[model samples]
Target chain A: MTAAGFPIVRAPAASATDVRIDPALVRRWLVTFLREEMIVRRGMRTAVVGVSGGVDSALVAFLCAEALGPANVYGVRMPYRTSAEESFRHAGLVQEITKIHDVVVDITAAVDGYLRYEPDASPTRRGNVMARQRMIVLFDLSAKYGGLPVGTGNKSERLLGYFTWHADDSPPINPLGDLFKTQVWQLARHVGVPREIVEKPATADLIRGQTDEEDLGITYERADRILSLMLRGYGQAAIAACGFRRRDVRLVWDRVNATHWKRHLPTTAVVSPTAINEFYLRPVDY
Target chain B: MRGAKSRPQPSSLLGLVPRRTSLDATGPSVELAVVQCAPRKGDVAANLRRIEEAFAALRHDRSPFPDVVIFPEASLSGYFVEGATVEVARRAETVVDELARSARRACGRKVGPFDVVVGFYEEQDGQYYNSALYASLGRRPVLRHVHRKLFLPTYGIFDEERFVSRGTSIEAFDVPYGRAAILICEDACHSLAVTIAALRGAQVLYVPSASPGRGMEDVEPANVRLWRDVLRVAAAEHGIFVVYAGLVGFEGGKGMSGASRVIGPFGDLRAEAPFEGATILRVRIDLGDVRVARAALPALGDLEANLGQLSSMLARTSGQSVPAVGARAARRR
Candidate 1:
């Protein structure tokens, strides 16, 4: 039940077309976006993607390979000790198919190096540490490899605040940032990502058995529809009329409302009217 | 009465513009070039260099460019420079002089009796405006007209209203061949600007836009699709040629898809540029088509004839006091 006094009754699932996209158009746009943002705008000819065997990163790898040929893309596979072996295999699948510059830098020692000091740290903290440590490796490699660090988080995870804040969304440019997870899967299929990787349950691979759906308590398919509708200014009553489960709507809405800060730059106290990003803005270079 | 006889003609008496009645019955043909550009953000000098290169290329190949050349809105500065617009803003007079000089230098000779409509952030009387300048560049250059954008879109990725002051006028200016009007970006979305230009006997409407392409659900970018619809409708309804020039390249991840095109008098796609990058969409437009189309429909003619009556009805509908010229308008029609 929602805090707004709605029932928790289950409803029929929405048609996939609710989050469907024209894959050809989307692929072209993303390729253009990647080239413009990374190469044309910043003079970075290459890109390094932190491929985690998930659909999102794999899709980004495929796009980067297409944008700046396969040779220019470095697909770095980062696995902690607890990460599933399937993660490494899937990341390998992406590298094999795209023929991207394959690289594997296991982050176990780096994550464990920090966590050994805090033995009683919670799983969430430990996962965050792993995520941050992977970012450190990817960024350092970006310098060594002479490539931009491509972001792989989709709009659904961004809205749900599913990924670590700075560590996951910290890349300078993202081709998939605006696309919802369902749409990302659609684009993934169009761009020829492996069927197994496309069909697999999405996971961060920070824990052994953790899946994103299980952690979020809702399917990405449902959450995306709700998030898209909510952002389009549909109220609770309007959304409920669209045949969404009240419980799912509540979960998606709460997460989106709660994690709004994760999507933004740190808010600074405005002592002057001309505060940057508040009153002052230079849109292109931001 | 605000009928055809009482219609406003701002420059008719000055003899700067030939009145509509005096124009040849068989209107002239104009070769138009809509140049899609990816202007560097906050760097007016770099963008100017690009503009100069475009002119150089055009003049080098064809000599005297074309009858009309249109660039995208904020061609002098990229679209989303919110506060940086103040730094890039130029006075209209200064811009025309500089543009003329650049064209002459690039062409290595006196270049245009041609019209060039270029959009820029403008500063006049200590006020800033998003403006499009229509000028005839040659040995004797004339600042034909400057259309300061009237409707500044403030919501949804646009903060134009906050950065620039709104323009209050929408009038067609006389080109060497015929009358034409400029509508910068958001101004084209509002039908009133087009209607005013149509009433003033404009045969061509130039829309310079820097609108970011949005949505992935369709085969084409959503904004591009919508702009096509609007451009088509505006062209066909008013029996005018609609030339749209769009910005290409991404601005902070917002891709401005360059789908610039020319919509004919019959609401058909005359010529279209590619969506990916900078390219010129060149097409020869016969102004005679305007007369043929308007003759076929006569919608603009009927509206101009009965405007005084419609104004009173509109006032009544909006709960305002009605004006007194209904009988005269009906009789005039």
Candidate 2:
């Protein structure tokens, strides 16, 4: 039985639906993890977060303000000229609610300057450039303000490889990295995030009228549930039997397998008996 | 010469000394719970509140409540305070009174009375000691036993000797669960202390430790493995049950290993908590096993026979000086 007097229920081997989380316990765990990772392990008193007006970034900013004082938390909003006005407004709402130090850096010139040389550049290239530019700004502010840059990407996006490498995925500390996108929404509501932001359509805001579901061809709710079942070693057949479409299960399974490289360190050819991070290993805190 | 001859012969040769049978045979069985909690550093009230919440949670679930609840060493004020002031070291009586009240309030009328054993920096007259207080709660609370740490570790990452005064005595005190003894963290490192307590009729040894986790691998921490070996050997050798309650969480950038466990007299692990986070490890132990194990081995009986001889040998060696090693070699040549 858990601390809440609820017996922990386990799914049978043939079943595929056993992903339940206690939000209160998860909140306590995440808060403690953030406090320990930032203050105790990294010796940082301040945190910097990139708030994009999305649920994921909004939740990260709120958690950072809760872990470290609002004065110590800095929220940066990086918007290109073509970014949605609603996104900017939502970011402002988060800043006001969390009461964190806010900075707005318009990246229209930085992104457009790089794109001028390649006017025929694809949308993906432009989106990647914008994401990297925002990261550079966030990191510079982190150095100037003596705060660690916090990552806002969630587990669902990470498994789907829906982020730019070394851009949106790189941070010294990440509180929401382990939580699924659906779980992030759940925790956002629990932490009193703005309801408008929580209910907003998930998007990258890099291009006009582009939504995450439209790009991925699957909803986060369905994808998160499929990923949950897949993570528990459930086969595609088992997942399909659990009231999920067979094609959706197969798509998520293939995406997770194809993007396995994004989740791990670069593979090194081992010549020595003990390689770094293999045998002669130490924790990042160490 | 006549008086010496009339004195009784040593029990080793004559076997005239009647062996003291195990008291555990007649003692009642005990249920014990060890709490591995992450305490907020130097926050006494918050730590107490955490303990209260755990206790209330256990009772509300109607789980098998333990007869004795143990917390980690320095759990009230935390460990590794460089220069603790008098305000940091709380009065033992006050903490005990509060715990007793909380325990009674949480488990009142539904369960049998239980005792709480917790570690804290205790303040007496102008001096402080790293101590464990055992409070037995029934109609009211009673401070049953207090054991100050005997050996203050002064090695790497440990400057306990510089911070707190050392206790000078080893004893076994009677509690609700027969004769039991308390040993703070470093005291468990000394086998002689455990031996002395076992010899003094302690059937159960409660070791409250604040040992930090040390290692680089994903397996059990080195300190945790070492503590397990220590507790296992002590329990098996002395034919006593051992309960080790360890603190968890980080303080001053150091991580604590929270592998709290209960070991039976046969050196078997009854219950063990994980290496991280907060957990309550509970186990039911039949005190009769202490008597059964000792009756099978009878090492305590052998120690009783040789204790006098060992004492005399130590006395004689202290009174005389041995020849130098070089001189003895030269004489032999």
Tens digits of per-residue lDDT, candidate 1, B167-277, equal 998888778888888999878987768887777768899999987888767898888888888887788778788899988888888889878888767676666776668
DockQ of 2: 0.03
Top-scoring candidate (TM-score): 1
Q: What is the lDDT of residue A68 in candidate 1?
A: 92
Tens digit of lDDT per residue, candidate 2, span A1-286? 9999999988857534544455655565556667887886667989999999999989988888888889999999999998999999999999999999989999999989889999998999999999999999989999999989999999999999888888888887777776788888888998999889998789998889999998888999899999987876888998898899988988899889989888877889988977876655433443
* Per-residue lDDT of B257 in model 1: 82
In order, what are the TM-scores of chain A for the candidates? 0.92, 0.92
Instruction: Summarize candidate 2's per-residue lDDT along B246-327 as a digit string, tens digits.
Output: 8988665466877888876766666678767778877767788787767766776676666666555655778954433221
Q: Largest DockQ belongs to which candidate?
A: 1
RMSD of 2: 17.4
Docking outcome class, model 1: medium
* Predictions: Cα RMSD each: 9.0, 17.4
lDDT of 1 by residue, A92-184 (tens): 999999999889998888888888899999999999999999899889999998888999989999999999988999988888888999999
Error of 1 at A161 (Å): 1.0
